[model samples]
Target chain A: MSELAIQTKDISMSYGDHVALDQLTLNIEYGEVFGFLGHNGAGKTTTVNILTTLLKPTHGKAWVCGFDVVSDSLNARRQIGYVPENVHLYEAMTAQENLRFLGQLSGVEDLQKTIDETLELLDCKDLANRRVGTFSKGQRQRIGLAQAILHRPKVLFLDEPASGLDPMGMKMLRDLIVKLNAELKMTIFMNTHLIGEVAKTCTSIGVLNQGKLVHKDTLKNVMDRFGDDETLERLYLSLNTQKVA
Target chain B: MFASRYIMTAALRANLRDQTVLLIAGLFIVLVLISAYLGWSATATVQDVYLKVVEAYAAKGQIAPPNPVPDTPPLGLLRNMATYVALIGALAGLVLGNKTVSGDRKSGVYALLASRPITSSGIALGKILAIIIAITGLLGVAALTNVITFMILPNFSLSADEWFRLAQFYIASDLYVISFGLLGAFFAITSRSEAKSLMIPVTIWLTVTFIIPQLTANVLPMAALNPLKAMAPAPSGAFFVFTQSVLTPISFAEAYRALAATLLDFAPPGFKFQSFISPMLTLMIVNGLLISAVVVAFGKMDASRSAYDD
Candidate 1:
């Protein structure tokens, strides 16, 4: 009964002669952890980039929080927080400074408190004063998350948030994502290749292959379609092979 | 309000943290010191040479040396130092501005910043302001050193008026350099590589500052002619008639005629249209045009495009 947080109608994008997104239509409801699965060049980043207003869509339209992504970009940008794949920070600045800088840019009032709360929420309060260049991969990931959620965005777009994290780090990030969705009532749109992570955390899922959405359903629905005998990993492999053939 | 302030603070901090910035500032200080010492030594040598020449002329009784053989330094040394300072300032601006605009793209910071709510114009403005502040600080230190050198030199009384005039010239020169620097930054943002951006500014600076000045001074004979000549009254009497008969406009014969007319009590020339305001106004207009072009180019820059690729 909740309204859709994101809606796209036959969206397509191309770069030069190459098609990046092929008439992909999708709808994600409010407060759902929507996992977007794709291979290396499966238009995942491209879709996110268009949704986040970093790139203009070549065709069709996308609506984020009831505002068109292209025509109402300022509203869409104000409504969503994006964490790019690479956790690049101002290496010269400390974690706290980076959070504060991003928080202000996101129009978060009481910037110092927001930075502190975000850092504390990520359990990075102790590392707040440390320069990002000195932090480990997991620490940088945590800081990146802190920056993304600093403004308490209605929807969070995370691109491979746990890409290079250790097992423990991955668990920690997964727990944080679940907590953010449940406690904050935020919609999560994540792009990743970690089927295990997606299976464990996602409430709804969409699989992209060769610039097209091949599968999309709730976790239970996807599991039912594949049956109990087949694992999600097996289903993914079989689907990818089908695409290749 | 707070967001803009935060962005500016971050930009200033980033610029200050850059090792290349520190290196450039250190290099500037070293160059200023070297220039000061060389200028001082050269001025002393010129005074010594003048003293020797005067003493030799007096010894030969060829001409009586003027009172006390005044040890006035040749004005050229001071003027040359000012010119060097301006040149170095331009070079510093080119390097710093190029890095400020293109370095972010090269380092992957541009994409990150662009995805945020920060506009391209805001980023460009913050960067340009930071560079201007840094360059102004460096120029201030150089000017202070120049003033101190003049004060310390023996028998070199640099009056307040002269100091003001020198400062005015330096400020004008700095303005010109900053304008070119902004142009360089714009080019760097648009160019495929930092080297191309840097080369364009340096080439333009060299052509305008060195080549143009040389050509204006030496090659253009019409530029040298006084505009007040048409306003001067015709000469009278036998002296003028005789000079007019002997002289022609094409040769130094005209110069001899003028001297003879002036020596034989011809009236002084009338008021001329010559004024420093015209050249100064032209320079200001040129600076405005360059700065506006740079700003417009910066405003149109697309952050998503790769700065390293054409």
Candidate 2:
């Protein structure tokens, strides 16, 4: 297997004249929780979409766990799980039902047992039998997390996972992400604008400005260098300002 | 294959829970039952009246007119079923097919599906299989209802040949209904707006069901609903001849009616069908094209932008 869980080379995506992702290259090692920080329309979702094999980049190449996303999408998909910004499962189905379908698609051998174990691990076992339409955003997020980790994919992609969560919800999600990474050894790529959540959850951080990567480093290293005089938010802003100039 | 099966199951479960789909299917089944009951009631009433007239003629020592009731084929009693299937059943199919794709698209589940190990073709196959199963199940219920109605009605026994003909009638109806389902699904995959996806196929359905028949077959608006009248020879005119030549091959609704009427053994007096192959072939071709269109649309669809515009 390739050492990198995710890799991209000069990957650019253009929609007509507007470039969603410019000639950007990135790499993330296996088992690292990488936070991708970008403002709205900074091509964060586009990047996650490309890595997850939901959309192919217009130019350049990407791979997930040694499989090219475009040429070997199925194999690449087999190694990854994704939860979009707004997780929309079949509303009429119960939480377990939704998980069962997605798990089966992932080729889970002992599906029922896996579902039970995953739900218990997420601490939302009580939400299993209830219809997803009735759940709040936080409850749905738990179920969404359950689906992504059901197959124990080597890499998990979360696009704006903290967008609609309350403080407790955010904490629960952060804890779950950390648990999944530490326990399952899964590589996580999370895209968000919330620097605070990044401080709490992500081990490494990359800042994207105007579809360009402005800064990339481990959280500890970044904090060591820029933490004393300026907050991470100010540091993030300064990086974007420099990129804009 | 396994992924397709899972998708099929998920789609079926979601469709079953959908109120709009449920209502349309329920209405269709109920119409089938009612059609059977009404056909039986009409046949019984006509027979009773005919018997009474025969008795009066016997008392007067004059021969009664030949029995008109026996001249009607046993299967002909359910001829109205063809119209119901053509209209209401087709509508049911459209809704079912639309919901299969649009539901996922609208709910943003397509993103999740696209990220799975399954290919787009697998997803399409699963959804198409679901439509096939659902439409077949509905038609099966209608067929069983017809059989039960025959068993309960007095003097309405079906022969082996009649039973086979009844089955043939439904098979033809199935093809006609499934085509509409595929058309709806085709639009759902290609059209950006959900309303356009549904409305476009509905407009096509309306055109084929009513307008095309009137132009090409010289069938009146209401006569289009009756299988026997729908097959009457078109009136002689250059315009009619041109339309008939141009539209007949593509007029699946007319073909279905003619094909269904033949199976049910309904025909106007002294009007002989030149051949059954023409109508049968038309339906087969039309269905084949629609299926291909659906497969192609699904294969080429961009999953990232599949969500509706409106």
The candidate scoring highest on DockQ is 2
> Model 1, range B124-156, lDDT digits (tens) per residue?
667667667767777788778777777766556
Error of 1 at A132 (Å): 1.5
Model 1, CA-based lDDT: 0.70
The positional error of residue B114 in candidate 1, measured at the CA in angstroms, is 1.5
The residue ranges of model 1 lying beyond 4 angstroms of the native Cα positions read A238-245, B1-4, B38-77, B151-161, B192-310
Q: What TM-score goes with each of the models?
A: 0.78, 0.95
Q: What is the C-alpha lDDT of each candidate?
A: 0.70, 0.88
Tens-digit lDDT string for candidate 2 (A93-160): 89999999999999988999999999999999999999999999999999998999899999999989
DockQ (0 to 1) for model 1 = 0.44
True contacts kept of 2: 0.87
- Clash pairs, candidate 1, are none
- Cα deviation of A174 in candidate 2 (Å)? 1.2
True contacts kept of each: 0.54, 0.87
lDDT over C-alpha atoms for residue A1 of model 1: 23
